[model samples]
Target: MTQSPAPLPPPKQRRHLREAASLTQAQVAERMGVTGETVHAWESGRTTPRGRRREAYAKLLASLTKADMVTNTQEAAPPPQVTVCLNKKPNPRRAVSAPTPAPITPTPITPAPITSAPITSTTRTPATRTPASTSAPVAVAAHGPVPASETEPAPLTPLTPAQAFDALYAFCAPALVRQTYLLSGRRELARESVEQAFQLAWQRWPEVAVDRDPAGWVRATAYEYALSPWHRFRPRYRHPEPPPADASDRALLDVLLTLPAPYRRTLLLYDGVGLDLPETAAETEASTPAAANRLLNAREAVAARLPELANPTALHRRLAELASAERLRAAEPTTVRAGSERRARFWTRAAVAFTVAIIGATALTVRTAPTRYEPPVPPGETVQGIPPRSAPGTLSDAELKLRAKLRSGILHGPQRLIPLAE
Candidate 1:
């Protein structure tokens, strides 16, 4: 008896799906809006996603795994080729001036039996058709036999909102991260920006999935998030290594980095990420004409260093190919450590408290602070120095007492002077 392969354990299965999707536990947690421990628990089989969460979990796994399977199958299978026969055999019954046959009375005819022989055309010109045994019917046109390579598979049926989101994430996440990386010049930040954008997209997927260009919407959202100034206050990005780069790419990147931010982003969008001028402008928040001008200027800047890139067409093509190859590995989210969220919460509360304290202190100081101080003076009192009045011609009782005290040496200075108003 043949032995069957062992089924994957729950933890292994969960890890396999996560890794296959190029996602980290933190990313899954963020998508599920749960803590990393919850995801870990589910993956470890200590717990399982239940109810609607289970439904979502299954959908996520199916979408990513299916996408990978499709890609792999396509890569492994070779394209089908159809052999076209050019020789046209003349019909033995056909004559240059054969008289038309008369119409006979209608009669019931037995259907011909299916045969193994190749089906041939009854007309003067013989048509080539594949034998039924070989493959499905090859679509033939009146003009000529259609090449097998020309045929395309039927488009996929519309997916539900959740499936659509998962599919979108699987298909576009890597590409989106690459585009954002080229724009931001930071690999980890690029990933975060894309993740944040995808998070937003997941929340509003009903509107996003139905858009004409869902990928474009995601990319645009990422670009906007990457450029946001508030991103600085968030945890800094850390990565094991930078995205791979070749000599030519490194050279181009070095030169590209020298360009101003607007020009750099415009160039990357137009050439690297393959956005059109209008889309680029919309993403960069500029007009089409302005985008065109920036692109022209950016190309000139790049061409100045790499003279071979002077041709706009060649430059766009080369840059687009180079940039599309940069698939960033999902960085392990470091900030998701236990209690980090709690720490963040605590800091947030602390910051609010600090702000309130500062404001209260400022208001109290303003309310209680003394205004420009001035000594109070009796009403009608002259604040100015007055010249001493002429000595009194006659001494009053107080002056007599002062004189006696002065004579007795009890008084000093000018008061002790004799003839004190005598």
Candidate 2:
């Protein structure tokens, strides 16, 4: 008879759910599709929660990032301290001036139960890896300890709150934008994705603020927002596609965009960022096998555009000859919604208010017209004619710039956009 593989080991201890969800064990258990006893058992590591139930469990964990619920605990058996290489990316659109956190370099996985969980740190390793070159601000506990035969964890310094936010911004900003860019191929639209994630983090910064790994919080937030396209979650986005400079690139992007978000992210994270099925599974919170399927589905969908990844381009060409059926579709124009219009108005009003302030400053200067003092003329223009000048204002150029900036500040400023505008 066939022998079954061993069960997966226990991850370090973790609270079944955090308080941010404001959910109790009973509520979590209900969402987890198990008995309260089962929830306790899983958290306690008495027995493993399996199958579709486990998927549901992961989904709940991913979504539970609602309010900032900060909990630090170990599961029955801690997961191996594997340093995940962060996917480092630069946003082509926005200017991010923050310092990047160091790269994560945990000990390689080993197959033994070890004491003292290797805490996460923020330090930089060489840019040996792509995308995930940055370090994690927090060392996250694995769902279970890795095999003892694997790598060892190396110690590194942890980042400060400012560093953490910087790292968080850099880490998630590019990844989220890239995924959105690949799908929408529009910078403004991609920015919408980034802004949504950012607003959520700001709203719940207190709880998510302290975690060693803030990128996880932000990334999870981005995914959560992108998960549903309901009106509640939709943000105003009025981005136009950058006519891909190259036809091939344009075709490639079109094909890539056609895939669903789950698959789209999986593709970019793997192909563009260099993550494997298992780790991709963890980041996206899917089972390794299920994540594999999502990746496959995404690839299949893009095969036509990215034929080499899916099928041989030469063979596809030959097949095209045989089928003799060519179908072309007219591209649909992008439409900006009402909320986006409101956002646009907000910026416009701010611009107008700023212009008004500048005009007022000019008027003030005219009102404070310098006393009309006749210049003292040096006697005799026989040599070099020069007229004496009067004293000017006291403020320095730097001080004047500061004054101008401050007086025009929007602090306690009136609302820029009207609540409802067609």
Candidate 3:
């Protein structure tokens, strides 16, 4: 008798299902509200789905494969009617029936026919689980494949950008928040930026997943979005940072926001994206020299605006800092205005009024007081850095003319930028 081959992986089934449904790892997490790593573990069979999720995953696959079958049927035979045998959920009934096989061959039950449109990967999620590396159970045929089992189970699946970023943020939101807070001068905008950036990342999971630096992509995107002028017009809400899910969460996003758009854009490409000037130029659609000039000018302008922060001499400045989710999501829509700035404005106006009162008082005091002068000396002797009149005890004609000319300046209104002498 031919020995039965090892149970095969649903490789073709999975590939087709993935294509038909366009499920990315990020979308998988978004669908299930789980981490990206969890989906990786599921595809690798490190963990298994339970309860409603197990049914969701199985149903998604079944429906997707069936849809593909309908499309391919234009030139080929239709898929044979499939009797989907669902696995039993954990329960006491299963314990009672655990050892009992059906008494004999029983009639198969017909599952309901499904006709939903293909769910976009951005919206729907795949079954996700954590890797059970230490005690992984062997996967029996999941009703997906029963025909081929030649090679080792096709190497575990890959994650899409959306999925990877979802995983990264799931693991590192807190730190991202803290970093974002430090990067952004204000907290509310940073928190929203992080959240919005991750949401966008999920929408484009495939391309993002394969990207060399998805975290960088997300960060760059977040900063750019926060820097948009429209963001300012909209009333900002608050969400504090939480415990970070990963190490890369430590990037400060607020600093980029503090700078002008042109400078921030330059910094995002050259620094945040880790591109050299030429690559930055290409990515930003500018010439290399122009990119380089922008970066330099931006840096100079940013430094000038924040002298204390620009200090290269301050070696203790951390290149990275850790943050957590609790903090990222903590700030509410309120509590952003600086107390000092508000108070300073009020005090400044008060001080101007006070100065005007003092000016009036001084004018009254001057008018009420009498003026006096001292006796003049001989012409040869100097009095207050000036020649005295020629006659003793009397002012000379030339001395009187000079003193009057000097007093004319203070008696007049302010002079023009061009010299009065001119």
Q: How well does candidate 2 score on lDDT at residue 309? A: 49
Decreasing TM-score order of the candidates: 1, 2, 3
lDDT of 3 by residue, 270-337 (tens): 54323345546654567888888888776666466555445432211322322222234522211212
Worst 10 residues of 1 by lDDT: 112-121
Better of 1 and 3 by TM-score: 1
Judge candidate 2 against the unseen true structure and give its global Cα lDDT, from 0 to 1.
0.50
What is the lDDT of every predicted structure here? 0.61, 0.50, 0.49
Best by TM-score: 1
lDDT per residue for candidate 2 within 1-422, as digits (tens), equals 95443343243323423323335445666676544434544554545656777666755665553322322232123434334334656556955443334432332221111111001122121112122344433334446544544443445556554454444554345445544455455555555655666655654556767543455456556555555556234454433444555565566667765778778677655554343455467778788888889877876777755566464333233222211221211111112123334566787899999999999999999999887988898787554576766787699999999789666754565756333433
Ranking by lDDT: 1, 2, 3
Q: Which candidate is the best by lDDT?
A: 1
